[model samples]
Target: MGWQIAAASAVVVVLAGLTTLALSPLLGRGRPEHGGGPDRDDEILRSTLLVAGVIGVAIAGVAGFLIARRAVAPLGEALARQRRFVADAGHELRTPLTVMHTRAQLIARRMEPQDPALPAMRQLLDDSRVLGEIVDELLASAVLTADPGRGEPIEVRALLDEIARSMAVLAQAREVQISVAGPPGVWVTGSRVALRRALAALVDNALGHTPPGGWVQLAVDVRGEHVVLAVTDSGEGLAGLDPAELTRRFARGPRAADGPGGRRFGLGLALVQEVASAHGGTLTLGPAPTGGARAELVLPIRS
Candidate 1:
């Protein structure tokens, strides 16, 4: 489009200049020589051609800008619709997944360990729970991508404690101890739901990598003008994997896909990173002191 506009503008300018020159001689030919004959006519022609060229270029530029904007408008609308669809689909799936998980758990409770169907029931329950988590992550990603988060003061310590408590059951089932530690009353500004989901993703990723009987820790603290929420596990730290690469959607480390929790879809860390950025924060990944991976979501402390 740009090239075409330039070409057309060039052609118009050239034609205008040619027409002015062609008319100059005729217009000046019979005029009195003393009345500023051909020389004055030539000056008028040059000035007219120059003005015409400027006007033509200006018009072309304006047309090109409007054309480019029009061309991209539909693409923007399409992307927005796609994000909305993903978010809506994920939200709608949550209820059914919760129902299925509840039913599967109820069946498991009624079945004897020796029953032939017990294992299958347990597997179904696990699958349903994992599926629910995936849906939640999907919704989080869609929301973060589509809209900027509303930053409001959130109680950081309480949030971490809630997450730790909620995830305790899963940690125990995997024989990995999970703990939370933080000072009280520390606050940050961000969307509470988004921040909670980000923390959940970090904890889930940590638990997935930690070995049986290993420990995972969630800690919140204030450092200078920032609030930090860190999730560290007792698993092998990053294993020489690039932290930046792991933050990319669907990018996983070497052991990320080989855990007992089954294969991770690799959206967890990516969602964490997105949430952090939306809240004017940073997500850092590094080796923990205890030889495990440490993921930190750092946000500016709301004054």
Candidate 2:
């Protein structure tokens, strides 16, 4: 009777093992079975295969993730290096351009007003200045794009005021009324130089696009933990552009070339957007209340 009971228990164990093996293939939890599932050996093979499959899937996932990371790293590094190269090249080119401009200016001053060389010299000087402006813009853009992680605490009000004052001359030349209305001493965490450049670029854009006798207003207001700096130009506003598109690179609005001083517009606002982002800020463009376009730069306040 004891022998009979032992035999029955062994049969039950064998049947249970066979059931697991038979279901393994249907569940896709096993590797290739080397033998039929009716036997105990087949059951062991199925259990081993199931464990191996899980291990294989885990290994594949890890390998795939590593490959993806490796692929992205080089592209990011290349973009950074390219931006640095552009900045360096622009900086180096500025010196020679400045010398050429000076030489042209001197030639124009020395020549008689009616002389044929006078027009040529004047044109050269004008071209040189334009080239210099382009180089400055390129250098600024490259620097801003390459390093969005570089910013320090800055005083917003003073910076905007300073830029406003500096651009006052150009605004005057175009007979455009320019003003700044904002409180002082608002502190923000961003690269001071980059912040200044961003404000100047926006102000310049406004002054450029505002029709002669029109007004360009710059205002900075503290909204909770964010500082909002806005520049408005009273000229033909953006051509029904979606506000979101304004932040895109090279997205020049139709009004860009139509400002007070007959402005040559391209990439100015793009740089402003880039600078804002580099400082972990937001930029927006919309229609001003005075029937023109407005640009706003919102930056986080430094604690």
lDDT for each candidate structure: 0.80, 0.74
Candidate whose lDDT is highest: 1
TM-score of each: 0.57, 0.59
RMSD of each: 6.9, 12.7
Model 1: residues >4 Å from true position, as ranges? 1-64, 105-123, 140-144, 149-154, 163-182, 186-197, 200-217, 221-227, 232-242, 249-268, 275-282, 286-294, 298-303
- Cα lDDT of model 1 by residue, 1-303, tens digit: 667666666766776677666666666575666676677867767766766677666766776777788779999999899889988899899999999899888889999979999888888988998798778766766765665453557899999999999999999988999998988888876677778888988888788778898999999888999999999999766777788887788886554367533224378788788778867789999999998888889988878
What is the alpha-carbon lDDT of model 2 when measured against the actual structure? 0.74
In candidate 1, list every pair of residues with a backbone clash: none
Report the C-alpha lDDT of model 2 over 1-303, residue by residue, as the tens digit.
Answer: 445445545554555556556655554445464555567556666675666555555655665566567668999999888888888899999999999999888878889988977777887888999798778766755754665444456787788788888899999999999888988878887666667777888888777677788998888898998899998889777657676766666665554364332333367667777778767788888889887888889988877
Name the lDDT value of residue 131 in candidate 2. Answer: 91
lDDT of 1 at 40: 89
Clashes of each: 0, 4
